[model samples]
Target: ATTSIAPTTAVATTSPVFVPVTEPPSATPPPTTDAAVAPAPATTIVAVDVPASTAPPIVVPASTAVPTTTLPPPPPAPVTQLGVVQDVAASGPLTVPVVDYGLPRVALGDSVMLGAAEELLARGFAVDAVKSRQMISFLPDMQIIRDGGSFGPVVVIHLGTNGPFSESTLNSMMALVVDVPIVVVLTGRGDREWIGRNNSKLRALPEFYPNVTVLDWEVVASQCPGRCFYEDGIHLTQSGQDFYASQISQLLGMG
Candidate 1:
């Protein structure tokens, strides 16, 4: 019985077997497995496009300019005839009559007398001239006019060149000729001593008589040109005759 039981046990009875199961070290499971993803990269935003605006241009007004003009000067005024006559009167009146008494051959008084005669004829007046050898020789003639009292307003006595006369004689003659203007023309051509003496006598006459007039021959000579006199330096030429006539006519206002 013992043998039979041992065989059966070896054959059918399995000994107590230990199965070893490895559970992957109790499933720690890769520490619950959360994946470590990289954090997302930061994003930057920028403005892409912008618009520009335009402005209008400014305008200015123009200025107005003015033009300048120039004017011409006026013409001079004309001289009147009355004014010319007044000027002539201011120098000496042309209304007075003239009587010339001078020697012709000795002192060229004939040429002067002829010129004066023509001038008086043009001025509507009668003229006469007497030529004496000397002024003293004409005393009788002057005395005749004085006695008759027919002499005019003016008597031109041109003398005292050939010879010298005393101041007393000249004064006496002047005194004898009364009631008229006596213009004593001093001698032009003569020595300086005679001229000085005649001038002295003339100056004395103004003190004695107011009616006595003294005309300067030197002044008349200054107005004469070279053609007015002859080459002899004493007498007047034809041109001188015409010039004297013109001067006398102008003084008388004949033209």
Candidate 2:
């Protein structure tokens, strides 16, 4: 059989048949992704130092000042002058000139004078004292101190123990002894109120008459107590007599 198969072979013709094939590419589109965010850092604290020279100084307030004051004291009381001289013009100026000579002491009184009679005589005093006789006023005794009687350069009056007094009568008695230099008054005493008043009047005589001196027998009565007076509180006792004499002597510039 000489039948020859037509040789089947790839024909390379001018217009060749072609088959199409598809495969995924290796460059895929970038995968879709979100951006990453970072966290912030923490804050730190720091301390500072200060010097003493850089600091402010402190101040103090002062106290207020004050003033001081001083005062003086008062004057002392009178001694020989017993009290204030109120009635200085009770009488005129001293008329009788004071004679610096031997002045005799003459005393005029009632019973109290009698007690001191012997002592007065012994002390050179001419005493006109009455025994059991009453001189209740300055009237009856005016005659005794007048004329050339008990009136002398120096005299003692111890009346008014039994009665009241008159200022005129006392002034008159002083007038009767106007020529006399010194007159010592023996203050009277009794249970009567007038007695003290009488004594006060006598004490005030120093202002009116320069020669007037108060014996202050009241002082003697107070000092010597029971020994200076009798039971009646009016008459002078024996000790009183001695005391009276000594006082008169001192007044007469003898003791």
Candidate 3:
């Protein structure tokens, strides 16, 4: 038995070992990681100062300038010569008024004359007046009177209150009583534009004809300082009528 145990050989046994189960690292990173990004640059603001002396001035144009107003000239001044006869005075030392009331007298006019009809009749004048009478329409009546030989030595005419009369018409009217002494009454101040123009023609009559005379009633009526006229300014008040009658009377040497 000893010989058999000695002849048996001894056998060797090995055990298995394990390395860590790690895989190779990837080329791209995982979604769990977030990368930080850089921000853009901001703009900066700065302030500047300006000088007052270098500023531009405001201008206004001459074409757009405000216009000035022009008013009309005033009426002509009143004539001073009332009833003077220079030729007659030059001829002799005797001086007489332009009218004679001793002879038959006629009064012709418009509504203004009608206002003083009774007063004129009292003063020995045949009153012939029509309301709103124009000089053109009244010329025919004057012609009728001239043809009939009823035109008296003295004539008092007050017209042009209703409307305008031409220089030719005035001349023709005066021709009707060429030889007779006539008294032309200047119209009072009124709203009518023709009043001043008519009075101007009336005032110049004596220059051309010796038989003509102006009563200058405009001057006379102005003395009352707005009391002489009724609201019409062309017609007379009671006091105005008295003054009117008295002026005519004085002119005729009756007052």
Per-model TM against the reference = 0.48, 0.55, 0.59
Show pairs that collide, candidate 1: none
Instruction: In candidate 2, list every pair of residues with a backbone clash.
Output: none
Regions more than 4 Å wrong, model 1: 1-132, 181-186, 191-196, 245-255
C-alpha lDDT of candidate 2 relative to the true structure: 0.65
**Per-residue lDDT of model 2, residues 151-238, tens digit only:** 6567777776766668887886777666566666777766777789888888888888766766766655565534787777777788
Off by over 4 Å in 3: 1-103
lDDT by candidate, in order shown: 0.50, 0.65, 0.70
Query: Compared with the true structure, what per-residue lDDT tens digits does model 1 show for residues 30-125?
Result: 564488868899888887776654666666768767776777787543221111121232455334334454221111133345445554455443
Q: Which candidate do you rate higher for TM-score, 1 or 2?
A: 2
Best by TM-score: 3
Give the per-residue lDDT of model 3 (tens digit) for 1-255. Answer: 455545667665666577779989998786664666556778777776765686578787668758888888996543323453222212222123344333477888888778888998998888889999988889999888778776655677888888889999998888887876444454535778888898788778878876667766666666553477877777888777777776666665565
Which is the better candidate, 1 or 3, if ranked by lDDT? Answer: 3
Candidate order by TM-score, highest to lowest? 3, 2, 1
